[model samples]
Structures are given as structure tokens and as C-alpha cells.
Target: MNKFLAASVSPALYATKANARIFTLSSTEHNIEVGNWKIDSTQLGIIDSFFSIEQKILHGGKQEGSKIIILTSPNGLTITLSPTRGMSIMNVTGQDIRFGWDSPVKEVVNPTFINLESRNGAGWLEGFNEMMVRCGFEWAGHPGIENGEMRTLHGKAGNTPASKVEIEISEIAPYEIKIRGLIKESTFKKADLQTVAEICYIPDTYSFTIHDRLTNHSDYPRDYQIMYHSNFSKPLLEKDAQFVAPIKEISPFNDYAHKGLQDWATYLEPTKDFDEMVFNIVPFAKNDGSTLAALHNKDGSKGVTIEFNIQELPYLTLWKNTDTEKQGYVTGIEPGTNYAYATSIEREQGRIRQIESEQTVHFKIKYSALMNKEAVDKAKKAVADIQGAQKTTFVHTPIAKE
Candidate 1:
């Protein structure tokens, strides 16, 4: 019943991409006041190579500062892994963020490597951005889980495919775009990232795969990982930063926090005082532990709600790098598929769900950028209004998931 303005009244006025569904967006209407910080895309406008992505605005090219980039879809599939907090969405006064396999979207470092390292000028990664960037997250690189009977395990990354993706810019709601990518069970390495692949006939499901080659070629097992390494602007986060999640328990980052491993959802500024930022295995305080993730800020402006559903993934990671100086100034609320492998431990012990090799997973994540008390009230009212329209299983309040 959350009255998420999924469809905007704003009209689309751009070129379309063949057969696609366009959604609405009021994102372009805001008047922004960008600061002295000018964002120049290295891959595009900036004279210097900015190690960014090739971007083409779908609408409203007349905004002020280029800090946010908002994306929408019918199904809940937008950002992944280290998703942007107030970041992305070409906002006027939200936050700055980065993206990609190994590097960040805002050019925190060069666009080379994922989980691995490539030293050099790319080390420009030092400084404020480094402290704010998400790092050291991991995941299975191919579709489904890999099981082992004796020695060898799941198939290599190249077992699935990449051709399943289908992108379309809308003709009707041309402002919103649609991307319908799938995994027809072909190649694995092609789908490195955990992108939800379309499965025809099924109600709600996502298939993902991976494909990577370990260059050293040591006669051994190859461990793989792929998560969108996101880093956010720390200065913008209030002053006294803290994280919140809905989880009952959390694996503290090297056992760091207020006292011991309390509920994983709430975070306090580590006593060791990391140079940058990191909220270890955080979650939302009230979400029934059904989801994972949390949002922290300085001076405590209420708090943002970030959740990771079990459909697309299961694990959530929190990396705290607070010992360095200078750029080491931020923290991360990392989300993942296997909770540092501890989730698996719980599952095997019958505390959580377990998956056999080659099993498909599916879940939906709902992101509501609730502003102070105002936004929370709006959402509550929305849930109330839903009962007025169509009969819901529950009443007005957010019912706990059974």
C-alpha cells in the first residue's frame, strides 16, 4: 500500500529505443544548486579521462549539478550490491556515489579490476573517495549454487550466457526505460554480475551467471565475487553517522561497534574511529530481519531505510576501513548474497534456508527514500489508503512477515 509514485505525470521528450515501455518521472523538475564541485564525465565531456561510463540522459537535460541519476522500473530492479544511498539519481542536494564491478561510477579509481588489484596511477583511488567507497565484497560468479560431491564443484562461469538482456526505451512513457534480460541456460562467465535474468512462465524469479579467467592459471580452485562497489559522499551525511537494519543478528566487522554484536541493524561510530566510513553488516531496525541493509548519516538526520530482499540475494556484508587518514573518511553498508558465508553456516544448522547446487532465487527489494517524519507519515497514510481501495491481507500498519 506504500503509495510509491512509481508512475510520474512528467512527459517524455526524447528518442526511443525500439520496442520499450516508458515510465513517468518528476525527477527533472527540481531546480538544483550545484556547488564549486563540477562533475565532468571522463568518458564523455571532461578533457581528462574520467574513468566513467558512457551516459545519455533520457530526459530533462537542463538540471544543475550532475550528482544524482534516478532510474525506475515496473519491477524493483534498479541499483545492486553497493547501491547509491542519496547518491546517483542526478539529484540537486542528495549525495555522491560510484558503481561498477571493481571500481566506482564517480571515478573513485580507474575502471580496471573487480575484487582483484591493479596498482599504479589508478591508485588515484587514494583520498576522500577511497574512504567513502565500498570494497572487499564477494559473491558466486555464476547462475545457481555450485555443489561438491568429492573434489570439483559447480560448473565454471562460462556455463550460462549474456544474450538474454533486452533493453527498450519507452514510446508511451518514454521517460522510463525497460530492460528484459534473461538466461537461457547457455554460457555462465558472460553474466558476471548478479543481474536478475528473465525466466519465462515463472511468476517471480531471477537467474544470474558469471565468467572470469584467473590469469595465473595455478592448478587450483578459483574463488570468484561480483558486487557493485558503491561509495557515498561522507561530508553530506549529517555529523554523527549510524546505520540501521531489520536483522536480528549481525556479524560485526572484526567484532567492531558500541559493545558487542547487538542487532545487526543499528550502527554506531566505531570507537577505534576508522579513518573512512564503514557500518558493519547493518540492517533496518524494524524490518523483521526479512531483509538486509541500513543507512547512516552524520549529526543523525532521522535515518534512511535501505533493505536487501531475499529474492535477488541472501547475504549482506559490512566493510569498515577506519584506520587510514585523509580520504579514509566514510563507511559502507554492503549488501551481498551469502552474508560472509556465515548465513550458510546458519542455514546448514537449520537456522536459515539452504540451497542445493543450480537453484534459482527470487525476491523483491522496496526502496522508499523516507524523509524525516514527513516521508514516514506519507508512507503510513499510503498503507492506510490501500485498504480503502482494494482489500488487503493486513490492515494499515506494516504487518510483520510471517
Candidate 2:
């Protein structure tokens, strides 16, 4: 058994016949590899259910050698996760609505083919198609030199492959399905960080949750930053698609973004050769410190929502890239400890986070598909309630110093 699983799962639970099922797909320490495997409800003695998980490796092109896990829920939702790509979520489909973008770089390019230092440090864009990808365990932001060290775009968290991958399914009512991956980002005499990424969902739900725990394994305290880059495209994102959030404060990312400041909460039709705009935001939260952001289609009939604890993720970034479909039209609802700027700039602004040796930080985000007008309306009202009568402070210019 993997060490992580042994520590998480109770021995008595596995001792019972109706407890849960655990499958280890890959583990370097245990020398375990179950290539091209699958398990369904029938195998688990589950009655009349559609829950299943399949693991396989892709072949050919830049995607060759990439490991993908396809999960089918009982509620007609299908998710594709790439463990080889730092456990990033590749695609999500529910009720004929896809929760991912149409990027020109279609393949799930393996990290082996991605040279983060190439193209002047913008090579991360080559494998930038995931619906949700992590940025940073060390540094995350624009490509630049920070304290004489070259930092690439968004850091290397998303490109670092998982060292262990496993699946667990509860036998109790609700029967939660969990896909966990352990990723290690380490270097000698520098940084040693480990992230345990888990994606969990009930058997019959249109929603899923991401729970990640990042630990500092070094003997000394280290500074770090992390961000969840959640991207979406049509049919949830389209012309007139509104980005609804409980905004307390907001600002344009730069001068170009200022041009679209007035329409920051709305989206436009896909335009040819469109320049992307970014906004930095501080959101209003509920009493429990939980907040949500939603993207609804033009008619409000379909949408998606992301929920997180504002105390853990204090900053939000809205990325609007409504370019032509051929150019990969998309928008990103990013949550992070800091905004997306050069790490040096973030450090100067005192936004970077730090962890003591052997300490861990936890992050959780819930994503749900809104399939009806009522669901969309409810989500919008929730944001509105959080906003209440508070006026939003809109900055005419960017906030961070460059």
C-alpha cells in the first residue's frame, strides 16, 4: 500500500468487505504499475450504477506517454484527469456542456516535451489546455529574473508529473469517489515541496471538489506561492456571458486591461486577433469566509460556479481572452494567495506566502455545473447577497508595482 493511502485509510475500514475500494495505479516506491486498467460499479457489487474509472496512456505526438484517468459518474458527468501533468483536470462534460476550452494546442503535451525555459520562458503555454491547473509550489507568475534566478511562466507545478496515483471509492451511502495524486517538487539545497492533490465527487452529483495539501519538506522555512488556474469556454462562456462575483474591490491588470474595465464583469463575442485582458479582484465573502464566482451564458440557462474559502485564497484574477475559436477563446477564474505578476513584484508587494519546515497548507475548491435557469439564478443571487449594499471599489489602473 502507498504510504499516503496507509495513513489516510483506516485499517478497520479496509478490513471490512463493505468499506471501500483502493487501487494503486502507479507508485515508484512500491514498484507498482497497473497500466491500462479500469473498474466499474459492477465489479464493486454496485447495483444499477454507471460509476466507473479508467486509466490509460496516450500514444503518438506530444501527448505520447501521458497518463490519463477518465471517470464517469452516475449523474452523467465525465471527467478526464492527467496525472502525468501534475494531476491537472483536462476536461469535464456534464449534460452535453463541456467545461473546458478549445485550445490550439490540443494534445496533452507531456512535460518531457515542454521546455519551460524555451521561448523566453513562455513554453508553459504549449500544455495550457487543462480546465484546472496549479501554478507554483515555489514561484508562479510572468517569466522574469527574480533575484538572479530565471522564473518561467506560472512556475513548474503543472508540468511536474505525479510520483504516485491512486483511486478510492467509499462503500457507504453517497459513495464518494476520490482520485489522489502525490507530486513532489524538490531540489538539492534549495526547495523541497510536496503536494497531495485529490479530486472528489459523490456518485450521483453534478459537482466535484478539489482538495490539495502542500507541504514544505525542507529543513528550513521557505517562501512559496500557489494559484488555481480554472479556465472555461463556451457554451458556458459566450458573447454577453456575465462573470458574477461578490466583488468588494477590483482593478485592471494593466493599461490594456483598463480599456475593458467598464465591461470587466461581462464577456464579448469571439473576435479575431483579440488582446487578452486581466483583472485583479478582492471578493466579498460569507460569514464562514466562503465565496463563489460564476459564469453564465447569454440566456442564463446554463452556467458553472466555483466555490472556495476566501480566507485561504484572498485574491482572484479574471482573465478574459475572447479571441476567435481558432485562436483558443477562453476565460480564467483564478484564485490564489497573490495576483499573477512577476514573483519579484509580488514579493515587493508582500503577497508571497511562506511555510515553516514540515508544515502544510490546505486548499479546497468546489466546482458545480448549473444545468437550469433556477440553478443559475440561485448562484447569482448568492453572489448578490454577499455583495449586499456594499459598493465595489474599482481602480482605474493596476494595483501592483512593476
Question: Tens digit of lDDT per residue, candidate 1, span 1-402?
Answer: 311112223333222224433222212223222222111222123332221112222222212122223222213222321111111121212222222112223332212222121131122232113222222112221122224211111121112222222222322321233322222222244222222321111101111111111121223222333222333334323334544434333433332333333432333332354432222232332233345343544443333333444333445555444332232433444454433333233334332332223333443333343335454444434433322343212122211110
How much is the lDDT of residue 242 in candidate 2? 93
Please identify model 2 stretches exceeding 4 Å from their true place.
1-18
Best by TM-score: 2
lDDT of each model, Cα atoms only? 0.29, 0.89
> Candidate 2's residue-wise lDDT over 335-398, tens digit each?
8998989988998889998999999999999999999999999999999999999999999978
Q: Residue 82 lDDT in model 2? A: 96
- Looking at model 2, the pairs that clash are none
